[model samples]
Target: MAENGTGVVEFVLMGFQLQAAQGMGLFIVFLACYVITLGGNLGMILLIQSNPRLHTPMYFFLGHLSFLDSCYSSVIVPQLLETLGTHKMIITFERCATQFFFFTLYASTECFLLAVMAYDRYMAVCNPLLYTMAMTPRMCLGLVATAYAGAMVNSVVRTGCTFSFSFCKSNHIDFFFCDLPSLLKLACSETSLREQVIFLLAFLVITTSTSVILVSYLFIIRAILKIRTASGKAKTFSTCASHMTAVALFFGTLVFIYLKGNMGKSLWEDKIVSVFYTVVIPMLNPIIYSMRNKEVKEALKKVLRRMKVS
Candidate 1:
């Protein structure tokens, strides 16, 4: 409790609330996932840096995406593992706020970066002559930096707004992590302003990024349609298949969690969806890219051969 009896000093996270046997089973499962997420993301980063063939605008954005996914998982999974182990976990007010900030920052940055990647693909496929000139190393870096900067501003504002509200209702958060919807439900003060601000920021980030991706793909699809040969169309579309998959998986979850009208109505269902995006998505991204991308697969084969020789 806070000194001003109206506020909560800490929150009790009622995690999945599984039985002892189920909790231990989930702990092992989540631990395995965390390990794979780290290995896959970090491995993707190393592969990109080491392979000269991957020294292109697309791979450059991908390296950052892998880094973001790694950090995103790190922000939420460790605490979730603890919660699964104990069936409940306690987080201080400041700690919970910190988690929310970084989580928002990484997630928002990823949303923007995916859009940037879609544009990168558009330049390559829809405007091949200008691709090299348009997406230079310097330009790519500037776009990535802009994404990070925008995410930072959104995170700072959302975190400030969310924490500024009084949590006098109860200190029990229904979700595993310090998610915005879950925390907002515990706010005792009038949360209309905070909710509005959070919603507007979220709407802008998701909508703006989604719009960019949709437009980029439309242009890309037009270009593909103009190709005379089936092989040419397949090759051009293949370049973007992995990115399309990633965007759908990432944005689909965001739409369901943040944009839905029936939030806080189904806590159990929310937990499952949250786990899919936070825990499983990170582990799947590298796999998706590696499996769908021939260049990445070839690069992995070369690296493996070198390891065997050494």
Candidate 2:
């Protein structure tokens, strides 16, 4: 069976339509989500950058996380809004491929970054005396750089393998965006190579991140147990809670989307899961971290005071 390059030049995404009546309502809802996502992530970035109090290694990592979320949301939400508005869900092949590439890149980068954050918490909690030495400026920079590099490599490999496959049949992508699994089903050629590539990449990235976070927390828990005072334990747990929540939410949806059996699932199923990571999580990240963190609150206040004075 050779590849089928038939009449279709582009794909029309059927984005979650229960009925015509609900389209307007859904559009309004997602539009609000996009606005909040943009505002929250950008606000956190500005807050971290402008505040002298937040110039530490932790805040430095956080600022980058916010930036990543901003880019991540930008890649997905605008197109989603357009789809909602015009009801013209058509995306060019090149544009769809580019969307998947960057979306995968930033998402993978965030996974690694979250692992780094777990390690940061572990050191800060477990080895407070040596925290400065362990997590130096150079080390932080190196960790962040590694995250971006690893994600880029993964994106290149995945996108290359996907695009290499021949698209012969119906060009209409069933989902709202170009996702690996959904796109794979549309390939007219044998997807043995692509399947193997996706499995390997998913296993490597997910396993490594999960292991790092688990090990780091083990050390963190051990250190917390060694603390004699109740107040001290309470304080340490408080510091880690927000990050743990974020990690759990992120990896949970990720695992469900990618790790499920490749059964007869529709593209709409994938799109719903994609929404969690693409739209909802980005909006929630800053709210999760900043609203709960003392440092972020203090930094915001300081920044506000400075602005008022200036």
* lDDT for model 1: 0.93
Error at 179, model 1, angstroms: 0.7
Models 1 onward score TM values of 0.97, 0.93
lDDT of 2 by residue, 117-194 (tens): 999999899888999998999999999999999999998998888888777666766677777766777777888977
Q: What is the C-alpha local distance difference test score of each model?
A: 0.93, 0.85
Candidate 1 on 22-123: residue-level lDDT in tens? 989999999999999999999999999999999999999999999999999999999999888766588999899999999999999999999999999999
CA displacement after TM-score superposition, residue 249 of candidate 2 (Å): 0.7
- After superposition, the stretches of candidate 1 with alpha carbons farther than 4 Å from their true spots are 1-6, 262-264
